[model samples]
Target: MFALRMSLVILVADVWAKTPFMSEYEFSRRRDELIREEREYAGHLRELTADEKIVDNYLEYLKWQEFIATEDKFLPSVGLEGVLDDIVNSKVFKTLKKFPKGGNMHLHENHILSKKKMLDIVFASEDFEHLHVAVDVPESKKWRLDFFLNPPAGWEKVKGNPKYTKEKLLPHMTMMGSMTEFAKVNPTNSARRWEEMDPMFSRLGSKVIANVNIKFKYLESYLKAALEENVQYLEARSSISSRLYTLDPDPKYNSTGGKRYIDETGGEYELQENIKFIEGFVKKNPEFIGMRKIVNSYRGASVSEMYGDMEKAVRLYHKYPSYIGGFDMVGEEDKGNSLLYFMNDFMKMYDNTTGKSLVPFYLHNGETNWPDDLESSTNKKDPVGTLQNTYEAVLLGAKRVGHGLGFFKHPYLLNKLKEHQTAIEICPASNQLLGYVPDLRNHPANNFIRMGAPVILGADDPATFGYDHFTVDWYEAFMGWGLRLQDLRHLAINSLKYSTMPKEDINAAIKDKWEPAYQRFIADIKKEACAVDFDASTNAPAISRIAPREGPMKRSTKVYVFGRNFEEGICKGVRCKFGNAVVPGSYISGQHVSCNVSGLRRRNRKGAGKSKAVGVAVSVDGGATYISYDGQFTFVRNL
Candidate 1:
């Protein structure tokens, strides 16, 4: 012990002799300089105003408290399905949702409406009684809805059927089943996920939304929902090949129950009528800006079939240049034929539309995790790997690349993408749910941004994932990637700037619509963030102690928080944090608030008992700041 003490004294003397101490002023100056550097790097895209910084700081605090500071991982780390309810209830997500998301450049036409919205549309239809659902079907074909004059065998009328109620039908239609549990059990079964998802469009699209009346209603609802989320414009990819029909028994030009074409003879009356309907919708809802369609051909289609789609797409673009935004091949890149497989068709289309700006290609490229050289002669159905698809997409002059998850793999291609100004449609939520990224923090798109690639947020297929708006995508991108307010603003701007909208229209959208909305959003965030002056000593809330401070693990225990200077009407933003698990605190009066303390699992450490003790705190400024109580609360395994 004496030798150890002598050694310690000698070490301390050597450290003191070698280390040069700085004055308090110099030390503080260096710290401030470091903060400035961080702020400069974060705000490289755009500078935040004073109020915007306040909002950013508050958001940052919430992100830390919700993710980093928490004992158990919550969101952006776990599977999206597991924390979906948490996301919905998040004040951070709710606030961010109100911010203007300029446009959704990569959504599919069939997935515009949520599962609930689909049910609502069907339930309110004139032919509601005629809607029949196939029961006793395979798991893949569960609850398939269709319109029939006479209900077929194994099919039952949904209007009066208790079993076919919307509540039950929703689970079948949506991809939100026990996926969280499934992911936990079988973590790498992305193929199974795709197997379940492949038929979703067919199940809903051909049977119900393919109906012209329902299609129109779906589009209308889409516009309303987009506006609700403050998304100004939409660019929807569509095959335009669903044999559209009407359920009406008495139709003017009735054939095959009033069937019609969306793209037959490019100049078909049905196509014109649909365009006219969209125009009317835009005229009425000017805030919507407008909608544009990107012609789609599944990558799994045969070469000849793909060529036909290419021809049809070209013809549509020629006939209705303004309405047709661009073209893209839609399907799983890893499971389908590569962009190189349809090179001839694309080259022909490229030659025809070389000088044209409207019919540009927005290809799905570099969407897989496989290495570039993973090829096989036997398995031509599924490409060995698809990261090399980036080469063909950029060479063909694709306007944007869908997913582009593997773009960063090839530094040359990444530079080319930047050179071509092709934006990457980084669908973080879709990527997470689909298993390309189990934890969003490790997504490659973060590197894509850091490397100066143009990145735009997209939801891919919101309906299939059981969500409606693009805000969740934005939320994932923001939180998962540690994005600043300026970074988000840059992304929103990129959504408009890289869109297929004409130069004048894009300017109008950014200057007239988005700019004003962004200003208002920042102002609103500031107002809410500064609602309570907790920083002021007179108004600062001080937690004293909690009654029944101990709770059993894996259960919730209601605890009364005794505090002073609690604001009146603190119901909106009051959060009582027990360790890292935050819950809503009910304000009873100036001195009393109650909250449920969740008994999260405790980690076993050397020399530590079964009980875990942590500080309890209260935050009224949307988690911007918290006042800790004087005592620690214990969570016990058996209480």
Candidate 2:
């Protein structure tokens, strides 16, 4: 016992006595010098005004690091993971949580809610009369949430049916269902995994489209969430399946006594109604900027079909202009038909006039590992698919391309992207989830910024990965990717510069909004950095917490889907059945079906003095079974 006690004392002495490897005074002096150098580094860094959150982040990091270096007590070694965890939970993280994410040019419509809200807002609403879920069997069965215009006769039969219970739905709700769940991208076989991820995302988008009644409410909710996270702008991508736009139909006012949102009796509302709703929302909350909608022409579409979509998009863009901005090409790039496949036909209809192209495209290019995991043997024939897509997007004058991750593959591609000032919508979370980059530390974004190529951060499919707003995406890039404060400002500036907004508006926004915001940011930095170094002699500021970035510095995109059958390519003979209503020559092509709902007649106004209105149904397989769209059409007599 005496020997053991003596040994313990000797070990303690060994650690405390000579562990300094220098005199205690010298150690303290060197530490102070390092602190002074750090302060100097912070001062010299660019974009001081815009980097307040980053400054706060660095200060917090230094404070903890200083403690580790100066503390006399013995401490256990922490791994890199532990350090990252500390940063994730740090005050820096909270500050960054509210950093002004200038704009999210690339985003999916369905994934606005984080994990908790997905459970609460969506899955929890299963009790609603109109809400019904279909579990696609095979991959945990296909889980789809839909709204019923009128409760089908057998809806009650499946109410407690064991097959469609909450237990059945849970598998597709959380991380288990998110095919983009975190995992090391296997270089040898990421191809298969990425393919699986697509259907999962597609499935989610379709479900959300099917449940469009409360969409306006959700739009408000989504923007409110964006404001909380300090996102200034957003541009969401979704295909407008049909030209006919639908909102919550008032059942009682139409003819029905029940509260079926899509009941035919419910009167049809105009596209302008929803637009007005958004205009009011933005006017009410100055902090909430509006969202912009971009429609997609599914790449898998036929040449004529794509042209039809482009024509409709141009019409919408001309009519709404600001509300509906850009037309994009969306789908799995490698598997679907290439852009070149439609170029011959696409150019024929490019111009609004004889020779001028009015509708600009936002293409998705370079989102794949071309040589490594080709989607089809056909891709090998065009070995430069990624580069080709990038070129095509530029040639076609795309406003931006989402996930142009493979830009570095060709040296000239970077130069061209820079020349065009074409922004690459960087969705780190989405790309990582889909196995594009694998490790954020090695992300090509750093190179993109250094070379002055336009780059912006976005949350592609935020809901699919369980995120509430844009914050999760920006935060992940800020920390996980080792981006400093200055990098963040450059990104912010690029976002505004590359947006589809008018040049004059962009400049005014920068001068009026960005300038003032930056000034306030600098002031906040100065406030938190008053006592950074703690030497009795030095005047270094104390590293204190700073305030969160509050409200949008400017407006945001208030986007809502404009069409029905959001999925492109209406199958052959698929008909929208609305009970003998005069169909105004339906345009049937691919997934999109557009008919004039104005011809729809019901008992309320024209059809009868007293009769209940049911609803309209779409038959994908020529009436094998019927599915409902948002608004229903009824038969009225000849005018």
Tens digit of lDDT per residue, candidate 2, span 1-639? 999999999999976885553432235344546656654433323534324543544433433443455244211112111133343454555666555666777876556645445434555443344555544345543454544545433333225567655555544654325433233325223465556555556443444433444455566677777767766667787666522223345655233223334423211232465478777877887544467778777867877898888887787778777677778877667666777777876686565566556677777887776643344525433443534676677677777888888788755877788788788888865665555665565667757766667788888776665433465456556655546666777777777777777778677656665556655665666455443332232232121211111111111111111233312111122344445532222222212343333332233445353322335545434445545544432232321
> Which stretch of 10 consecutive residues in model 2 shows the poorest summed lDDT?
545-554
Could you give me the TM-score of model 2 versus the true structure? 0.64
Deviation (Å) of 180 in candidate 2 = 9.4
TM-score of each: 0.75, 0.64
Q: Residue 307 deviation, candidate 1, in Å?
A: 1.3
**What C-alpha lDDT, on a 0 to 100 scale, does residue 632 get in candidate 2?**
35
lDDT of 1: 0.74
- Judge candidate 2 at residue 214 and give its lDDT: 46
Candidate 1: which stretches are off by over 4 Å?
Answer: 1-44, 68-71, 136-139, 151-153, 178-184, 248-270, 352-358, 375-384, 536-639
Q: Backbone clashes per model, in order?
A: 0, 25
